[model samples]
Target: MLVIPAIDLKDGMVVRLYKGEMNSAKVYGEPFEFARAFENYGAKWIHIVDLNGAFAGIPKNIEQIKKIRESCNLKIELGGGIRDEDTIKQYLSLGIDRLILGSIALKNPTFVIEMAKKYPIAVGIDAKNGNVSIDGWANTDSTSAISLASKFKGSKIETIICTDINKDGTGNGINLDFTKQIAQASEIPTIASGGFRSDDELEMMLSDKYISGVIVGKAFYEGWINLRDIFVKYQA
Candidate 1:
């Protein structure tokens, strides 16, 4: 399992939100330096979310994201505001390792599947109370997380990132059951996102065959889990 660090960019600043609340952003600093720091911490990947892009349907942090790619060697997988073929091509042109489609996946699963056939892609299945949320978690749909994930089964997608919005940014613990259900339903390699707050939880997820990796945001920024130590133990 990879202890992937996250950098949520909003207006060129790094922030972490509470339960996907746009107003709850806590700014840390610029993103490129943090990407460098994560690389130095032995991370093989950096999960970046453009908070501005997600909510606004525009790439508001492209320059900031470019800096991250220029500064670090960590394989970058980016999401948020990625809606069309052009945007996907643009990001890949800048050397982003992969793309995670969220809102677009909910609205156009076929488009995503077609693109995944040629490009490195992943799907973000953010849910609340088992229902999928889209448009940057601002809207909830009737589709269940598992149901959405099942749509990508056999697609050329890289993975499905299952995030529990209620538990996200709470620094509580991961929703292991929810993640397991999505992974099983999709039968795809899955990555757990949000609420990864403790070492005990990490250990449990590591042993889980269904889970391929995790995205660590609030927990690492808040010092709930020491990245250096976790990397030393898990990266090897």
Candidate 2:
């Protein structure tokens, strides 16, 4: 599995939000610096989320994203506030390796199907106790994560980013059972996100054939985990 580093941008600064809460964000550093550091640490892919845009319903960190794109060779997978074809086209043109659709994937799945036909797209399913949450985790939907993921079984989605909000930013370790269930339900290569605590947890995730990758945020940022060490250990 790929040990992808997450760079969550809020107001042009790199940060990590507690449980997807906008007001609970902790600023890290500038985007360019973090991107460069991640590249130096052997990151082949970088996961970025525009926290501001996720809540505002439109991208708010285009300039910072563009700067990061120009600053490194790492493949970037961006999400948050990307709700239209025009925005999808614009980001891909700006050199994003992949675009992740969260809210639209739940609210307008047909649009996601159409976009998946044209661009490299993935669906971001944030869940709280198996139920899907949207609008930056501000609201909960009646659908379960597994049910939603199963709906994309025949679609062109490249991957599924499954995040457990309860475990996010808590350093509590990933919810392996929950992640495995989604992977099994969708038959999609899943990238596990949230509550990545240690190397052992990462090893377990990599061992699972269903898990394709992992997105590490607070663990990497707070020195709880070392990117270079993880790269050497997993060699994914």
- Candidate 1's C-alpha runs over 4 A off are none
Write down the lDDT of every candidate, Cα atoms only.
0.91, 0.91
lDDT (tens digit, per residue) of candidate 1 on 103-204: 999999999999999999999999999999987899999999989989988889989898999999998788989999999998988899878888898889
TM-scores, one per candidate: 0.98, 0.98
* Clashing pairs counted in every model: 0, 0
Question: Per-residue lDDT for 34-65 in model 2, tens only?
Answer: 99998888889999999889988899999999
- Model 2, global lDDT: 0.91
- Could you tell me which 10 consecutive residues in candidate 1 have the lowest summed lDDT? 219-228
Q: Positional deviation of 75 in candidate 2, in angstroms?
A: 0.4
